[model samples]
Target chain A: MITDFTPWQSLGGGALIGLAAVLLMALHGRILGATGILGGVLRFADMDDWRLKAALLVGMAMGPLVLLALTGQTPAVEIPISTLAIVLGGVVVGVGVSYGGGCTSGHGVCGNARFSRRSLVATVTFMVTAFATVYLTRHVMGV
Target chain B: MKLVSALLIAVIFGIGIALSGMMNPAKVLNFFDLAQIGAGTWDPSLAFVMGGALAITIPGYWLVFRRAAPLQAPRFQLPDTKVIDRRLILGSATFGIGWGIAGFCPGGALPALGTGEPEAFLFVAALIGGLLLARALETRGLRSKPAI
Candidate 1:
């Protein structure tokens, strides 16, 4: 049983995300959704976003390097799952986004602001599902 | 110019996710661990992140909405679909399972590449595969729908 509150870091990071979202919408008239952005670009010749999307991806990839250079440290990440689980999970998420139309950024962040009923519903649905999943895995299955 | 600006914004976003600790899968998975839901062990940092993001984006979006169009682009491009059908529910449920299992959603997953995590590479690759396959199916469905 442990609880930690990193108020400044969380708040600062979140504000940056908000700023990026706002800038994306303001400047490009696009949503700051990673899934939609990447997915749209992966569609071969059908995408008009190849160039910009490639640049955005490059920037995202470089973000940590910049952070590491500035802070001289990287955040700790522990993924306690096998490669198989990760692969399966990623594929499942892709299929889910295909069906639901978006994920956290698209629905949770952008869609909510737009006051879209679909986003609201989608957000609630995923949150509940996430809660239930953890409960079942941690409590019931003990896995 | 657009590419450079997009790169800058994405860099900022990626750094934000890293600084916020959202880039860590364990941090997010811990939040989803409902075994501590009622207990004091629950991590609420994600809430602060969500609140902070929404605090600025909400008003910022509205201000832009008031504008006839975007500052640089021709017009605002917003989603319009509103149906709450089975696809939405089932898809979200499926996504939740994967997220709960891995604690890495799309946004959380991508920026980890910046951190050079080996595991992130696998997840991103698999996600891309899923998206490509599903998109192929989606287009096929659309193409065949008219015939049926």
Candidate 2:
């Protein structure tokens, strides 16, 4: 029934995420959704400017390295899925975020925070689908 | 000034994600496990992260808006679209499946580079490819409704 819980870590991490979102909104008047940030990189013509977004993306790529140097703590990531699965998953994720309008940051954080009805629906839809996919893949298909 | 702040905040965000253990794939996968759905089967710790983030952000937004303009920028950029439609659902559903399969969303995927795993890089590459593909499609007039 029950297993592991890291209330403090989750809460704190979430707090940081919140802080980032709020700070970005507060200072820059923008949302910090990663997909949007990345996607915006390509549509420079329609956008007002791309410097800030590009900076954020660069900072994102380098931030973890900075964190590692500071805390000497390594990120814990394990991917045992097949190459095909990962590739397909990555492609779909790319398309999905593009189609859906945002990913975790956009929909789950800023979008919902703004009380955007579309965001709320999008968040619920994705979360539920993720849960179901996991169930089917893990429980049913045994993949 | 804006440039520095952008990088500073993003770096701070990366630290938070790392500290939060979101950079860990196993931990995230567990969060999505149906076996751990409710009380005890799995971990719901990550949900708290979302809660914690909202606590500050929503109010922060209100506070910031009180000012006529942003600190360094000329004006405020916010999302104003308000239509819920088929595309949103279908797009979200597809994104959800991808997330379930990899246990890594765009947010966490970047920090995943910290792990120094080749797979993470490959995933990022593929993700970029997908984004480019989406851009290509949209440029060809195949957009759903212009996400932003």
Candidate 3:
């Protein structure tokens, strides 16, 4: 119930994400999917590919550092859920992304942008489930 | 060049995630909580984030895909399969449950790791564990198809 409607920041941040995805596609001919990249690193299908994926993760880790350097403050992050919930949710997400072939970044952003039918289906499927899960947990069970 | 560019792109992506307030699980949960919409407390920031990204990417993809190849790679690596298999739906549904539970999607969680929070690391570690477990199942001929 307590959520900030940050339209400007959300839009700006989204544009940056779009720019990153576009650059990845334009420069490297690869989709800028976060989970896929991480999965590649874990899979280690090829040494060269592994290195590229690792570098992207490193960049992800460096994001807060860069923000700190520019603004002298680390971005605030809040995790309201319990440890048990976090781990449980994390595992589910991992398996789901693995089985589903993509996550929010891949299917929701880049795939949708490319007008891929599969991506659209994947996106809708996840969104519907997410909505249902939230409804059940917060309203039905109140957990 | 590819590694450097990939890193830069990730940084941009991470910053965007952080700036969009997606790093905050509470905010994400609020967005997922559709019941709040009628009460007038639903946060629509996530939608704006998607909208803003699409605003740029829709045209960007249209222009970029027109070329024969990318700047570095020999061919554009895209999803080849068009099949809407049961695995896709089931897997996505599973992920949706998790997303709703914690409000931490993979992309959002990455930037959150910078917060130096144990919760973030724990979630990521569990996520990796889940990935490995799924891969193990795939190896055993249980789950089919490679993730994108």
Candidate 4:
């Protein structure tokens, strides 16, 4: 049984995410939704919002970087899909986030945390679609 | 006291992810495939992670809800609607499909990317694209509402 259970590590990771989200909300009045933050960068709207957006993006990018620096652990598995396929996946997710009005962090973390009905619906939709897709990809198409 | 407590709770949440191996993309990807291969051989590590998270969060939620004033937000924000509709169903379906194919949902994926997996980057990109398109459509709909 090669089970990996590290309560301290997991707790630390979750704490970072929660702290980031909380700080972003408190300081910037924006939820730490990665999708939204990335979208803002791509669109490059008014100048006023740029600083906060940039900060959030850096914070996200830095979170993992900092962890790597401390732990020195790297990913083992090679992604099976092509770069094109991966980018296509990104586009699909982007479209979904747009229509849903929130990404997983917004809907799953903050909105759901607030117990918003819309967030609940969105989160469930996200989860179910993900399950079905994985099943089909791995089982049916053997991707 | 409320703000301090919220921050402390947030720290606990981060620690849980770090300890549970949920921060690792490979581990998470494996969990999604567990049902297909056979639960017997599946890695139950994340299950314990989930359990621990729930154990901590359930009580946390209860304590926070019991408060007269929200610690973080200006007021307590609870779900306003219980009705399920087409938007809910459709959105959920789309989200699940994406998660299944990618093996990364928004919350877990970003943190797991700390492992420097390129796939995580790809996932984040696709997620952003989906969100932007949705927003565009919404803006269009709002504009045409009065005309219709």
Model 1 regions more than 4 Å off: A1-3, B37-39, B139-148
Residue-wise C-alpha lDDT for candidate 1, range B58-119, written one tens digit per residue: 99999887778876678777776667788777777777887877678888878898777889
Candidate 3 lDDT by residue in tens digits, B1-148:
7888888888998889888877788888889999998999999899999999999999999999999999988989998989888988999899899999988999988878877878888888988988888888878887385464
Which regions of candidate 2 fall more than 4 Å away from where they truly are?
A1-4, A46-48, B37-41, B140-148
Model 1 alpha-carbon miss at residue B109, Å: 1.0
TM-score of chain B of each: 0.87, 0.88, 0.93, 0.72
What are the lDDT scores of the predictions, listed in order? 0.78, 0.79, 0.88, 0.53
Q: Scoring each candidate complex against the real one, what DockQ results? A: 0.61, 0.64, 0.81, 0.29
Candidate 4 lDDT by residue in tens digits, B1-148? 4334333333333333444565454455455565635645454454454344334433445455555654444654333555566655555566556655554555555544555667777777676666666666667875311100
Docking quality band of candidate 1, CAPRI definitions: medium
Which candidate number has the best lDDT?
3
lDDT of 2: 0.79
lDDT of 2 by residue, B8-126 (tens): 88877777776675766567778889586553668877788788878877887778778888777778877777888888899899899998887778888876775677777877788
Tens-digit lDDT track for model 1 on A1-143?
Answer: 24365778888888888888899999989888887877766745644478777877878777788888989986666786667878888887877776777888888888887778888888898888887887887789876
- On residues A13-121, what C-alpha lDDT tens digit does candidate 2 reach at each position? 7788788887787778888898988777766775445888877877776766887788786555666467776787788889888888999888998988878899999
| Interface CA RMSD of each prediction in angstroms | 2.9, 2.2, 1.2, 5.8
Clashing pairs in 1: none
Worst 10 residues of 3 chain B by lDDT: B139-148
